[model samples]
Structures are given as structure tokens and as C-alpha cells.
Target: MPRRLTRTLRRWLYIGHRWIGIITCLFFAMWFVSGVVMMYVAFPGLSEKERLAALPDMAWEKVRLSPDAAMAAAGAKTFPRDLRLQMLDDEPVYRLTGWDGQRQTISASDGHGIDGVTLDRALAVARHYPGAADVQSIEMVERDQWSVTARYDPFRPLYQIALNDAAGTRLYVSSRTGEIVLDTSATERVWNWLGSIPHWIYPTVLRKDNALWRQVILWLSGICLVVAVSGIWIGILRVRLRRRYSGGRVTPYRGWMAWHHVTGLFAGVFVLTWMFSGWLSVNPGEVFSSRGPSREMLQRYAGHDAPTVAAVVAVTPSSRAVEARFVWLGGAPLMLLANRQGRKLPSIP
Candidate 1:
């Protein structure tokens, strides 16, 4: 390259580096601080432990209807992807999930359809919560800052119930499933404001639409990735082992420029990795392996056979359980019980 052209290129590179560095460095600092908060208290979701704890144990005595009858009521031609017995306002009910992701709840007493949660039913659900206080207020949640992720899409129009607790506990009960989908205590809510919400740009208006939120985060991280890489390169280019024109110096720049250069030199790898990992979180190109279950795995677990209503009715309760699942153990049928406290156990029968 000619000397004049090289000079012009260097000048523009410096300008781009300065402005982009200012913005990207701000993000880098926020990411570092917020990442530590997330390390302990993650954004709230319905974890398995939490779900089990909230469940009302299986009322084996109340199960009068059969699984076959429940399937018939659902009009399912194939074996359901998932089928389990749960208590819906004290009565035994079957929550059947289909391979196509359709969910149907049928009365275990008489095999009638349960459309969704009513206001009274919502209140009842709240009253049954484990650490619940008197229900303060209940509102139908279409979408909100906390429940905007795609995972919550299936539970749209969830019932948000506020509890009169010191932690400002809130429960998101699915209207269709009538199950608690997300639980946020006051501590979790407060910490996430500094943690996940800002780091992921997770405001309701932007996050409600899953695709849009993903793109926004991916591109912003990509920009920061660029800035960090370029900064590392420039820091290297300007580094001097022996003094060029000053008292023994490794960095050519002076003052804030020198501090930015020195600090970035040591922390550049961290900054770069953080931005890259955040970009990977969106799985920009499917570089990482898939998360959770696959369709084939789900089908395999479901198998071809299903439990009959006779067996369901035959189960004698060992203890009060919130839900029960029929499973085959060593060729014999058994009922898996989820106690009110979330313990999983085999039925006495």
C-alpha cells in the first residue's frame, strides 16, 4: 500500500476504534457485573423442584375414570406424548400432552373437558400454593417483562397471582394447564433487574416477540465482539517492549489512553469471551448442540402401550400426592407419586 493511503486507513481505524470502544466497553463492564449476579440467582422459571413442591398429591381415591376414557375424550388416535394424573381443584384430572404439542385436561372423575382456569379456579389455585399467604390480587397475564420468553408462549394468558409475602412472591399459573409456570420472589425480582434483564436487553416491549429479541441481542453482541477484537489488535500494534521516545515504557500512549490500553491488554480475552458467549447463547448458527429433549426421544419414552383406567382406579394411595404418573417397572405397572412437598415415590399398591 502507498504511504498516503496507509496513513488515511490508520486514521479511520483509530476513529472507529475510539467510538466503538466507548460503547462496547460500557457493555463489557455491565456484562461482567451482571454475570456474577446471574451466577447465583438466575431469572425465575418453573423448575422441576418448584413445580413438584407446589403440586397437590395424587388423590388416588378420587380417580374414578380410566386413562383410556381420558384419551377417548381427547380424541387422540395415537398414544399421547405425555399423560399424567393431576389434581385440578381437589378432583383428579388427566393432563394429556400430544406429540404435536397439544394439551388437553380431562376430568378423572367423569372424563369431561377442562377448558381453562376460571377466576374462582385461579383463586383456588393460589390458595393451594405451598408458601402462599392470602391472595392479594389476580390478573390475566398476556405478556409481561418477566414472562416474555418463548418458553412461556404455551402458557399464554396465564393467571398472575400476587401473594402477601415479605419477598413479594408472584405466581404465574397457566390458564390452560392450571399449573404454576413461573415463580418470582422479591429477592429474585430485585436481583434480576441488575442481572439478566439489562444484560440481555430483556424489557417486555422488545422481548415479547421471541425472534426480535434474539436478533437484537445477537447483533449487539456481534458489534461488541468486533470492538473487543479490534481493540486487542490495536493494543498489540501499539505495544512497545523497549522505550521508543520516553522513560522505560511498554505502552506508547499516555494518560487515559494508556490506562485503557493497559487494562484492555490484560482483560481483552475476558471481554472477548463474554461477548462471544453471549452471542452463542442465541445460538446464532446452531454451532452448539441442541438443548433439552428431541422429538424421537420423547416418542421413545412414551412407547406404544398406555395405562388402562382399571389400573388407575386400582392404585391405593400411600400418601397424599399432587400428581401421579403411570409407568411400567420390570413388566409390572406402577404409579409414580409426586407428594405435596415434591417427593417422588412409588404407590403402596
Candidate 2:
């Protein structure tokens, strides 16, 4: 190649590499921080203590009442609304609220309650009761559950009450069995509530919908992947151009360019992998929900008949006992369960 053309190519490569690095630094940092947060802080789980503590300060009662009757009596007398009930481990407990809301523990043996707490009150207490600003309207759906769909003030975080009131005195009912599960405020689980911010990235005061933010992140990630690939190509081109320009004479940038070339070449694969995986992490339903392969396909990949598992746990009461299964793939255990719902239970055999 001509010397002028070779020099021009090198200049363009250097410029492209420099700008891509500069522009993507902030995004890379955000991704890194979010990833770390996700690793260290997991989604909320059932806390037996909190649930037990919320029960009315009554003595333990053991009765032979049906689950339906117990749930109905509890809901009508204590709760401000209807409740849901479920028989967990042969004991009927009010699933007043999900992991997302306050829940209750009812003694199945007797109608007496064991414990309960409102999720909103728990979150508020933990988060310093940062009262929502400008609650335009407060609409109560049930006793403990309400939806405040009004515009909140920019100074305060928008609060959604699935169970309990701001004062932490209301009782939330279970949707299934209609029992009063939690009787408290919305002032606990503050960290779990705050942790959702990165997933949405909406400021505490912002009222805008979160769809746009998610789209922006997805688009930026795609661009980053492209930039990473382009950087590798540019590095390769620089190496070739240098070799062609000074056939025998070692270029001044030999060491630096070599370092850049090797690093980019090796790291490109991992970076692209991370980019694609990260992108999927943000929008997993699009890829995993498609009907393409089956458990048989996975079994073939693993060279063994592996138990199929769902990626997410089903929210319904009946599917609570589901667990994930694993199969050996090239001597490494590959998790067959993709989501929390599909997590397998310990092998019975």
C-alpha cells in the first residue's frame, strides 16, 4: 500500500479507538456498578420473623377450624379488606401480600394469628419515611392495600401501597384466602426498595414512565458492543498497516500498538460476550420465551436426560414447591433452571 494511504488509515484508527474509549467509559462504569450491586444484594425473600411479629398480640389458639373459615373470620374482623389464603406445609397462612408487599402468618391449628407486618410501613421505617410528595389522590382498594396513582411531588419518592397505609396501622388482606395478614405501616425493606432504582434508574422524584430509560440503556449497550468490535478491527488494521509501511524498520509505536492489538483482540470476545449477555439481562423475556427448543434439546446438549426447569418461579400458590435441575455438560454442572421459578429442588433419588 502507498505510504500516504497507510498513514491516513493509522490516523483514523487512532482517532476511532480514542473516541470510542472516551465515550463508553461512563457507561462501562455504570454497568460495572450495577452488576456488583445485583451480585451483592438479591431480591427480597420471606422473613419469618417479620411475618410472625406482625400478628395481633393474642395468645396462640389451636382450633380445628377449616382453612376457609379461619381466613374469613380473620379477614372480616381484623383486616380492612379481603385476603388470600394458602396452605403452606399443611398449615394455612394468609399470603396477605407477596414478597413485594406485607404478608401474614396465621396459625392453622387455631384461628389465632402468629405474626404479620405491612411491607410499606417496613419500607418507610427503614427509609426514614421519605413521605411521597404531592399525592394527588389516594384510592383505597382494600383494607390494607391502596393505590396512590396521583402525581407525587418531585422532592419525594413516588410511593405505591400494595398493603398497609403510610401510618403503619392498617391491615392488609391476602388475595387468595381473604385473611388479615399484616397490620403495620410502610416503613421497612428500605434497601430492597432502593435497590430497584438501578433497574429503573428513575430518580426518587421523577414521575416519568420507566420504559424510556430501559430503552435507552438497551440502545447504549448495543452501541457499546459495536464500538468494541470496531475497536478490535481498527487495532488489527493498524498492525497490518504498520507492517506494510516500514517493511524492515521497526515502527516507534510497535510496543504500544502491539499491546493495544493483543489486548483488543483477546478482550473483544469477552467484551462482546458481556455486552450481549448484559443486553439480554435487561430484556430476557424476548429471547428466552420464544418457542424454539425443548428440554430434549438441552438434554442433547448435555448428553444426558436432564430435568427441565423454568427460568422464573410461578407466583401462584400451587407451584411453590418447584425446584431447579442441573445436568453435567462437559464435566461442568449446567443449571437447567433459568429463572427463580424453575429452580429445582434437591434430588430425591
Candidate 3:
């Protein structure tokens, strides 16, 4: 390259890195600190242990309708992808999940389908939790900071309830299924404001628009990656390795510039790799594997159609069983049972 062109390019590189670094470094620092906070405090959501602890033991004696009857009420043409009976606010309700990702709740007592949950029903559901005493209904939220992600879309328009306990517990009950889907304590909420909220750039205002959020993340990380690369290049060009500068120092600059040059020389590669990996986290351009299998792909993987409802009803679960999960293996219908202890009983097919 010509001398003038080389100088121009170097000048632009320095200028670009200097300006972009101001913004990206803040984000970089935020990511680093928030990542540490996230090590101990995770974003709030319902875990399996918490869910089980809140559930009242299965009232098998209250179940007057069969699983098949519940499935029929759920409008399942064939066997559902998943079916389980549990207490829904003191009533035995069968929750059915179809292969297409739709969910329905049916009353095992009267075999009536549950279409919507009233505020009274939501409070009842919240009261089932372990520490729920002064349970107060907050407001119906379509999308909020705690439940803004698409994972909660299936349970849209949730009822926010405050337990008013020592933990300052808050519960999000699904208005559609009448189930407590998420619970967060005051501690979790306060910590996550510094943890996942900033790390993932997941403010409710931004994250609610999934496409815009993804684009913003990709652009921000992409620009930061450029800054990292340019900064490394500039650092390499300025440092003297073979023939040392004044005072036998590898870096001629003094003060903060000297410190920056020395540290960048040692940590530049790691910083570059880190930024590159962070940029790749968004999986730009569908380069990595796409999302989970589509509906058609799932159907193909099933290999066979749903099991006949007759076959499903024919098998009887154990007397001690509180929950039953039905699935097909080797094109054969299988029924897996779980007792009150959450221990699996022998499969009955």
C-alpha cells in the first residue's frame, strides 16, 4: 500500500477505536460485573423443587372423571403429548399438553374445560404456595419486567400476586391455565437488576419486541468486536519488542498510556477472543443450529400418530400414583406414574 493510504487507514482506525471504545467499554464492564452477580443469583422463575413444594398432594379420591374423559374434554382428537392430574386450587385438574404446543386444563371432578381464570381463582392458586398468608392481588400484567420473555407468552396476561410474607414473595399466575408459573422474592428482584437484566440487555421495554432486542444485541456486540480488534492492532503497532524504546522500556508512553499499552499487550488476545465469543452469542445469520424442531419436524420424529384414546384409558395406574404422564415408545402407548413423593412408579402400558 502507498505511504499516504497506509497513514490514512491508521488514522481512521485510531479514530474509530477511540470513539467506539467509550461506549463499548461501559457495556464490557457491565457484562463482566453482572456476570459475577449472576453466578450466585439467577433470574427468577419457577424451579421443579419450588413447584413441587407448592403443590398440594394429589387428591386422588376427588377424581371422579377418568384421564381419558379429561382428554376428551380438552378436545384432544388423539392422545395428548402430555397429560397429568394435579390439584388446581383444591380441585383435581388434568393438564393436557397437545403435540402442537397448546395447553388445556380440565377439571377431573366434573370434566369441564377451563378456558380462563378469574382473579378469585388466581388468588386461590397463589394461596396454595408454602408461605402464602396475606396474599394480595396486585394487577393483571400483559408483559412486565419479570415475565417479558417469549417463554411466558403461552401464559400471557398473568395475574401478579403479592404474598406479603417476610420474603416479599411475588407470584405470577397464568390467567389461561390458572397455574402459578413464576415466583420471585424481593432479594432476587433486587439482585437480578444488576445480574441478568443488564447482562442480557433484557429491559422489558426492549425485550418485549423480540426481533428488535436481538438486532440491538447483535449490532452492539458486533461494534464492540470491531473496537476490540482495532484496539489490539493499534496496541501491537505502538509497542516495541525487538528494539526497546527509551529507558529500555517496550512502551515509550508514560502515565495511563504506558499502563494501557503494557496491559493490552498481555491481555489483548484474551479480550479479542472474549468479544468475538460474545458477538457469536447471538448466532447472527442462522450460522449455528436453528431453534428446536418445528411442529412438522416433531410430528415426523414421533414416527407414529398419537396413541388411541381407547388404549390410553384401558391401562390402569397404581393406586398410590398422584400424577400420570402418557407417552408412546416403540409405537406403543406407555403410562408413567408418580406418587406424592415425586417418585416414579413402575410404568403401566
Against the true structure, whose lDDT is highest? 3
Candidate 2's residue-wise lDDT over 196-287, tens digit each? Answer: 34543534334143465557767878788877888777656545534554645332356776566667777888888988887887774455
Model 3 TM-score, 2 decimals: 0.90
lDDT score of residue 9 within candidate 3: 95
Model 3 residue 74 CA deviation (Å) reads 2.7
Q: Using lDDT as the measure, name the better of candidate 1 and candidate 2.
A: 1
> Which scores higher on lDDT, 1 or 3?
3
* Root-mean-square deviation of Cα positions for candidate 2 versus the true structure, in angstroms: 13.7
**Total clashing residue pairs per candidate?**
8, 44, 0
Per-residue alpha-carbon lDDT of candidate 1 for residues 90-205, written as tens digits (9 for 90 to 100): 87898887777788889998888988877677777777777688886567889887888777777778889997877788998888878778988889889999999987788889
Candidate 3 residue pairs in clash (backbone atoms < 3 Å): none
lDDT of 3 by residue, 115-158 (tens): 79899988988887887889999999999999998988888899
Q: TM-scores of all models? A: 0.90, 0.43, 0.90
